[model samples]
Target: MLPGLFRNASRMYDCTSRVLQHYEALYRLVGIPEKEMMHSIMKNSKFELFLMKVVQQKVVTGLIPLLNHISKSNIEVDLQEVFKRFTFDNSCLMVLGFDPISLSVEFPKRTYEKAFDEIEEAILYRHIVPKWCWKLQRWLQIGQEKKLRKAWDAFDRFLNQRIASKREQLLSREKTHLEEAKFDLLTAYMMQEEIVNMGVCSKSNKILRDTAFNLIAAGSDTMGAGLARFFWLIATHPSVEMKILKEIKENLMVKDDKKEVGVFRTAVKADTLPSGHHISANTPIIISLYAMGRMEEIWGEDCIQYKPERWISEQGGLISVPSYKFTAFGGGPRSCLGKAMAFIQMKIVATSIIWNFHFEMVEGHPVSPSVSVVLHMKHGLKVRITKRSV
Candidate 1:
């Protein structure tokens, strides 16, 4: 059993312990063991086309403007913040059928954005401090817990408002007319007649909110964080960056103008690992991807370097590594559903930025990992951008 600290922190709405099962309890659409929702949202080929369209729109409407402003002014920009807002707006459009304009020049503040940040930070802190310490603070509703409560309220209110608006809009439209409207993931879930057959309006509402919450949170932040790290690493290693740019040009034909940027499963089925390691048949095994990625035994002598050549085969095509060795997008049935979408988004943004501009890290700006579920730059990656001279 775990300590009381974790046990107490688990009570918070922001807590994400596997034991909660809120997704399952709130709605069958999200919780269905056979992945019925995934079939509609991801497994279908139509979803792929939908994601492609979204990526194109985001690049043109959200990213290009930012680029134009940067190119005109020739000023340093915080790539990390830009990526976060870009992804956030994109995710909202894909999931909620709404764009918050988070990527605009003003960087207008939004309550939901604040809420998400607060909740994530509080949850991360819970993992660090003693259980009783947070528990006592939570009981008194003071410190971070108080902030969490306020954020939780704002998050709930924002979602509920959006749900009500979408519901009203759907009801007002004729069935045939509704088909012409863009379909976001939440709309697909809400329109599922099966979700309605399960019970009354209140039950449906709970499920809708839970489903929306999960999808929105899941689709946010992570992709952008990865992009930031990828760019930072690429920028620091000129050889690697050049190789990546050359590969992109050779493969996608992206020109010099672009100064750009940027798992799961378990089973105890086998008694012996392929490495000749023996274990009891039912023994639980956990794979540490972090460790596996750096192991010279598996990756050869240059495992530590950020080399893009390692990914290219002799045939000049991308080499495919076994899922076990590269657990980035994960593997098997539980692999990331948004892997393709992420690739498309990253490709579009990274290629555009790299060809158009060159990034120089602000001198002496420390870059380190933040303590959170996602790997983010601790102080954020501060950089100066200049247009690439052809």
Candidate 2:
């Protein structure tokens, strides 16, 4: 879906390409510092910073601030919980142009959390059950199909209302104040290929909706799940946890190290790294996200070990990680837009939790994948956190 969305139209988007090229097209645009806008639909560059500022300013501006608000309130919960809901809400706004405010603690709602989980469960069912069986069941409203139908209704009603509202706004006689409003793919589709214009939008609103929802649905959990697992690995493995802490201390000041949850600095140089601290160089992430955790290349002989030093170079920064070596976020034309966002957020969250708290697993707790498009832990991440003074 991501490859189809972006690959064919890349040549046509030469103008946007040239602009990003001017900033250094490394995709991993290195040692260069600049403002970065993370969007899942970045696959096409249609939503590049230029297009997004023009098309999605309201929604984009709303997201990080909303994340900030969520961060402030969810101190008791895991960072994944807050960031996942924040990204989910933001992705919905980017595609659908509204917020469900799932991150709001006191809101009158079951929260978007359950809705996200239900969609995850239903998707899993599709994988395990025969397609015909599931289809028939969906039609008949029996068993999990009935549950799935309810989710479909929840999703459809939400989408239909939002789509209808946007259509009304577009059809009104007054000119579209697109600059002031959220510039989402929905609006992009509406304007670009109207029945009179090119026939893309007018021929199929449902397809457009599906495209937008595809972006929303695919992005939400992959990032959140990766961070959750990364931290869980850190918390569970004392040696690896110690290494990451030492790495952090190498680059950070005593005061900086002491800061509470979410004290994030840019990826900066440590004044020095000890000589023995060698990292595997220029490797891409393993393509299978799970395969990454098990790869000897990614984590050395102790492939299953949770070693942050494996990601560190004796020379500091990342060890010249190539795009394809590790599939932590897929590879090639289908690479994740949320990669940088997840890394930055993970470092912040991991740093805070590890620095400020000591966590221990509850014995015999079940941790299995939630069986979604992305790998999320089912039954939640169960652990105990106690404040750490040092």
Candidate 3:
């Protein structure tokens, strides 16, 4: 659904458009055309670099305060939850231009955070059940759908509150005739009613909310999930862990004892298959990247193995595989616009953890992929963290 919606020429079907129309009045309003406009704003190179700097700053500041506690403690932590909270906080800061303080010592509860969780879980559950089942429940206002409605209300309230606050700030600044200094993604969208030539309005509370939602959806747990898997796989494979550590130390000029989190920092052109099959525009096509990465035919006999060495060529220039075969970050123009940003975040987080702590999987701990839009560990990644001598 994401890929198809991201297609350059894709348009919403009457049926899907009607479904959105039914719910539009109940939530912040945004439509297909607005979605395309937001996509263009995201793909802007200057905007992306701004976001990259935002993320980098967040990672450094967000993690430094947590290190002392983590490194001093020998107890196991739900690393999965840690990253999720961290990413959530970071995403909020980047998207809303305000911090929710979700990563505090007490891990304080906030309405917006709870609402975000509820809405995401409800949406994922909707995907799992039969469409008619959820739709009927929605109509009847019962069960999970009822909960979903409440969640949506809360979510909208949060967005509206923030939008109102930002608007007030902008208005006050206008009275003073101050320079427009706001640089958050949401702020950028709010400043522009439209790119006249582009024929799209990026303004409105509804559009602001929608753009923030899209950025969070793209920026949050997807990276956390990848980080969790990377840690788990490396922990389970000593050789792989050693190789990663070696590369981090020697290839990248990262010091092993840095207290600060180390700074880091595609569209399908065709509807036709190689087999002469045609995939209609706006069709919901599912591509399981998990399956693709391990496919024997595409990745060779040892595709199942966790071998980082395979990625390095004999000449040591780094092996390059076609993007389609290595669709982890996806392929084509619709491919993840944050591929580089993700790598930077992951490396900084990964290197910091590996250098400062030894991760030991809890004995008999069960680990499997959770069934969600993002692939997280089923029962969470349980591991003891012991400080390493650098």
Best prediction by TM-score: 1
Per-candidate TM vs. native? 0.80, 0.60, 0.78
| Model 2 spans > 4 angstroms off | 1-83, 106-116, 171-177, 180-185, 188-203, 237-288, 297-299, 320-324, 337-373, 383-390
For lDDT, the strongest prediction is 1
Each model's total of backbone clashes: 14, 9, 7
Q: lDDT per residue, candidate 3, 1-390, as tens digits?
A: 111111100110001111222234324355555555546666677666666666667666665456447657666667777777778877776677777767654667777678776776777777578889999999999988998899778878887887777776665656332132355567656555434536344366775666566666567767667667776776787776666566667755765455544000011443875768776655545556666666788778987776666666676655666766666655565456555556556666766667666687899999986666567778988887766676
- Arranged by TM-score with the best first, the candidates are 1, 3, 2
Worst 10 contiguous positions by lDDT, candidate 1: 1-10
Give lDDT tens digits, candidate 1, residues 1-390. 011111111111111221123344543554563256555566557666776777678877777777678767877677888888888888887777778888987877898898988887886677568889999989999999999899988988888887887787666655653463346776665565436556223336656676677666666676777678767876787776676556556776544444333012234475767889977656545454555666899788987765655666676666667755666555665455666676767777766666666788888989876666455678888887767676
Error of 3 at 33 (Å): 7.8
Q: What lDDT does candidate 3 reach at residue 305? A: 70
* Model 3: residues with Cα > 4 Å off, grouped in runs: 1-53, 174-181, 192-202, 251-259, 262-284
Candidate 3 accuracy as TM-score: 0.78
The digit string of per-residue lDDT tens for model 2 on 97-180 reads: 666666544433452446546766775676567789999988888888788677766776666677777777777723554543
Error of 1 at 214 (Å): 1.8
